[model samples]
Target: MSFAEPSRIEPDDNQSRGIALAILLLPLTLPLFLFLCLFVFLPVGLFAFLFSFTGELLFYLSMWNDGRTLTRRRLRRRLAAGETGTLIIEYPMLAQGRTHAWWTPDDISTLAPLPIPDRSSDEYQDAVLDLMEQDQSHPWDAWCWQEYTSTSQGKASLLRVWNGKKYQEWLARHYPSIPIVETTSEIVRQLEIEAQQKSHQPQP
Candidate 1:
């Protein structure tokens, strides 16, 4: 299926979120300032305010740079009919480095939708609660779909669809032949099996 126009993929502004966070935390310095004014000398109070402001600014700037690095996007060419090349899919995470997988046109088996799990599912609810407890932020809104591919070498993840609902819908419409699965775990299991097989292979 042909890809939508390049303009359709809205580029994320990486700095905006960091700036908002910094602004939200800026008020926290006021308490430190007050504390200093009540017990410390005037010169010491002024120094503390400057030090706190500078530290806060630096912390946010560091976060902004890291966010920019993780969310950076590059222009990708649309796949044409009979085209054969490597298609790379990236998974960006906040606590860990980004990971990627690749597949060629021949290796792809099907494209599947990855729906958000129902809130009633205990596993899903627990995962959400765990994230909340950790107080960590995430870059992804939702995992929209996945591309499953296989070869004699074994199965591999061809692509991970994120923030691409429209693109996924267009693909589903144009490529009616590809079977769409509902969950990601099945494909993940296939990948794990592949990894096990590869690990067991004798040294060349």
Candidate 2:
């Protein structure tokens, strides 16, 4: 299945913060180094300069690599081959903090799609009420259209489509066979429980 036009996923807030900090520190390194060289110790000054420069260089490289271009390319090829698997795009928070794995076709019978709850559903309404009652913020409270699950070797893997408008459109068009059925966090919790149970079961 073809993916929606690859929209560039930006680095997360933590990464952006790190990049900004690095940029701010980079200029100070030279002045600090110069002061150290003139006053206290040449080695200390050199260390300070090298440390700041290297840190910034590494941060920039990391930001560049986190773009996910390579992963998307690989995922497209795999999808075309009818491989139902999870593509972990690190830059996005779509998966809601779960271990990521891509299962081979031999690993599971099929990928089951879990539909997001509609506004009218009692479950959705209850969740909203709970949110107001608790008055607490949750990142995962955002609406998600569906979740895909696959099981292999007694373990379950959860997958969510990357949150890109174009990408969701592409999935709808290309993978209509994938049914969208209502699901909730309870389903994911159940899968985790089942996997744990399986793991604890003694092997023959």
Candidate 3:
């Protein structure tokens, strides 16, 4: 929950003439700035209006499935608290977000890819800005995950990143406990082998 001393991320307001602006101006600017992700699941949220429990259940289930050995919220939260685990993920992409895999701690279990949108796009920038404007805030990864949950991602993922130098530096400084590796064909191959081995084991 604690952040680095700087906690440098601040909400951006390119239009900060006065507070009165939001009362009237936000509606005017909103349509121009709204991104695809915001409205993409508009109906889903409407559906939740009828059965909110179903939406909450799906979101939590998504979190648990993506957790270590299939439980908890996220791997990085543990790493943030100084827990050690080799956190494997798709090779960091310049634009698109990356899928994640965290297995038996120093030991691993599942391997799969989750689809995500490009982080470097204008749509993403606007989406993040809109989320921040609403005071929907969390640490970077958690914030992104919150956005991801709104859509069909919950149906596919237990789980699901940024640029190279900036992204790597951020991860290293923020989470030093885990060895975060980009996936290579060889690494993916090994995980596949492990999955096959586990599949043959007697079920508890």
Candidate 4:
């Protein structure tokens, strides 16, 4: 029997960081050129005027380009790392069709609001710290999807090892009737065992 699909594993319809950074810096060069012409040189000749404009433009352009290049490099590093775990999701209160969503999951090295132990054992605290640090290392992987009413905070998803029972419960409660596909090793084995049991049914 086919199990339900995991609710969170859906295709993203958004621009990646590389594209966003490139677009952001594309027009910055123009202003740089204009500034250089105005302040750097006050000459009357055509060549001086042209040079000033070009220099200013190039200056701004260079800054913009540098910023974009840095952004792209960072984005590439994150993407190539196959970094996993955690996303802080934000969506609108109400949408006409679909909500406009944006998240900085890739660069997130730490997610706030995690449960912190108070005066606990050093060992336990250390472990918690490790988990939190790991969570930050790949914020994009961990996710919490919430849907709010016109007012009030929406329900938060339960922390489930991906495709585990907790995730299934979250789907059943929040999404309702949504299929929960178990992709985790433990859950998959449980499923396989159940399947084999059903298959071995004494002739119906």
Residue-by-residue lDDT tens digits, candidate 1, 57-108: 5633543444321121221333334334333333222222223333334422
Q: Which lDDT tens digits does candidate 2 get at residues 48-87?
A: 8787566545633543354412244555677788776332
Arrange candidates by lDDT, descending.
2, 3, 1, 4
| Best TM-score among the predictions, by candidate number | 2
lDDT of 4 at 14: 66
Candidate 2 scores a C-alpha RMSD against the true structure in Å of: 20.7
Estimate the TM-score of every prediction: 0.22, 0.28, 0.25, 0.16
CA-lDDT, candidates in order:
0.40, 0.43, 0.42, 0.35
Q: How accurate is candidate 3 locally (lDDT)?
A: 0.42
Cα error, residue 21 of model 4, in Å, equals 65
Residue 110 CA displacement from its true place in model 4, Å: 7.6
User: How well does model 4 score by local distance difference test?
Assistant: 0.35
Clashes of each: 0, 1, 4, 14
When 2 and 4 are scored with TM-score, the better candidate is 2
lDDT of 3 by residue, 59-144 (tens): 44655655413323454576556665444443322224433432224422122233333445576456645655664422333322
Q: Please, what's the RMSD in Å of model 1?
A: 22.6
Superior by TM-score: candidate 2 or candidate 3: 2
Error of 3 at 33 (Å): 22
